[model samples]
Target: MESGKKGGSMESEKKMLESNSILETIPRDLVLEILVPLASSSLSDICNTKRSCKTLNELGNNSYVLRYVSLEGVEVVQWEPSPELLSFLPRCEESGNPEALYRRGMVEYFCNNKHEDALKFLERATNLGHEEAAYVLGIILLCNKDESKEWGIELLNKVEKRKRSRNIGLSELRNKCKAIVRKIWLNNVVCPEEPLCSTLACKNNKRKRGQGWDLSDEDEQVMFDCKACKWDHERTLFHNMLCGSA
Candidate 1:
């Protein structure tokens, strides 16, 4: 019985070694494509892969893997990124990882008050097709001059198209935006000072008011047809989305 058990264990070990060898023989870029998604979704798999062998360990530790590694695990490192991440974030940002860019942009915008630089990072993330980045960028643009309103609405409308398609947690995103903005001085900037959209006297409150994020077609149509109300509805929605969630 003991001999049989030992023989089984050795077979397993040999199979594992052969698999590792096969993995090493594959092209580096191909391996990276497989590993990046794994790292992004499963924290455990990549950690074990890194521990299994030298070639993989080196690959897992390098820029390609680091670029898209799960941001969820490192979310705590975002606002108060550790000493190492201060240096590491630039590499991830330079590699064009949307999540990394979004995180670093938040730190720069909210924590460091580096508005121009932060906007650049957020813009890069949005251009890379990061929807959450687009949502936040839309709100930020809305907070700026009136000239920014058109582009702001354009970006937001793009995201709103996808808002209901997947289980992307648009509501949760709204709450998060409200929470982050409320923590800083930008809280009031999001809400227009006019009467609440909840009230009939709201600047652009036409036939009826639109709900926070759930405006019906007719309600939205009314809000948009009247420019004051459109801006009102949008600003109010943003304001309420931020303040409402906060």
Candidate 2:
């Protein structure tokens, strides 16, 4: 049995080596298609793949790989990176990577208070099919200027229908966004007054808004029907959350 196990392991190794040899013969562009996903999945894996052979090493460090590099567990996303590290983000942005745009947008918007720049980055990210970027962009729109509310709601509704994003649930995404808001807006974040629902049921019931409720959640949405009030409640709700404990 031990000998059989050793034989199987050797067979697997041989097959892997054969595959590697075959991969080296493929067109560089085709190899890049494989490299891009590897970069997006894990930077470490890309490095390992590059180190495994000379051919991969030559192709791995190009613009193609940097454009789709994953930032999921990268240090920059968790905190402000130093100046030397700053250039990395722009390099990734030059490739139009959605994750890079979203990360850079979050920092610029919340930390640097560069709303316009952040929005541009986020909009690009959303255009690239980033679900989280869409959610964050939608929330920012809803709570900000009046002209963008409709567009904000449209983006959010798209987010609401999706069950999973970046391997996290909808609730997790809400919590993540709220956590960032809480850390940044540590004071009273509420609007001056409730946007007030015009419908009779909303007026009579007056389900108080901004008490840590998710705007698009079914349970919360069921509590109010007026579109105006619902948006208002959600807008204030985000504000309240932003002001709440981190």
TM-score of each: 0.67, 0.69
> Which candidate should be chosen as best, given lDDT against the real structure?
2
Model 2, span 103-198: residue lDDT tens? 777777866778889899999999999877887788788766477867988887677657433344445555676655544533323342434354
**Model 1 lDDT tens row, 176-201:** 65555554444233444543234455
Report the number of backbone clashes for model 1.
1
lDDT at 14 for candidate 2? 80
Clashing residue pairs for model 1: 204-229
* Global lDDT of model 1: 0.67
